[model samples]
Target: MKVKVNRHAAKALKKMLEEAGAEGKLFRVYVTSVHGDHAHYDLKLDTPTENDEVVKSDKEIDFILDKNDEYLDDIWIQFFHVPNEEWLITNPSKGGHHHHH
Candidate 1:
């Protein structure tokens, strides 16, 4: 499994992880819904579980993904500040559509 985080998202996530009560938790990217070809993804602060795979991004942040989920692999997590502040999670290997969070 592989996870990619943009610089902006890395900074934002790092800030989030530094918040109160986020000590030992890592970011978890989960599938919220699955449409025919693609899936929707959401993030949360969580710990690794038996069924999870902890993938480290180039930004040095670790993400938890389901080991058996095909849609969870090769995910790209991005953040934008221009038009609006939002989180965009996409999987190019799947369908490459953006899901806002």
Candidate 2:
């Protein structure tokens, strides 16, 4: 699996981790639920579980991905602050047909 975290997201996540006193923990990115061809994710600071794959990004962050999730390949995570503060995690390699409501 390939995961990329943009600069904004990386900065925000680092600050959050520091505030939460979660330094040194891996950034865990995993599927919380799946609907049809779409999946919802949960991000947290956690220790590595058995068989978990670690993906390093931004030279200072480590992302934990499930070794079994092939659908997460080529995923991009972004932090947005224009309309509102939010995290956008998407698979750009997939077909751009996600319906938002």
For residue 39, give model 2's deviation from the true position in Å: 1.2
Clash pairs of candidate 1? none
TM-score each candidate. Answer: 0.98, 0.82
Per-residue lDDT tens digits of candidate 2, residues 1-101?
Answer: 77888888989887877875686787877777677777766677888888788887754677888888865666677887888878877766664322221
Q: List the residue pairs that clash in candidate 2.
A: none
The worst-scoring run of ten residues by lDDT in candidate 2 lies at: 92-101
In the range 4-88, model 1's lDDT, one tens digit per residue, is 9999999999999999999999999999999999999999999998999999998999999999999999999999998999999
Alpha carbon lDDT of each predicted model:
0.95, 0.73
What is the C-alpha RMSD, rounded to one decimal, of candidate 2? 2.9
Best by lDDT: 1
lDDT of 1: 0.95
| Model 2 spans with C-alpha error above 4 angstroms | 58-60, 96-101
Candidate 1 residue 84 Cα shift, in angstroms, is: 0.6
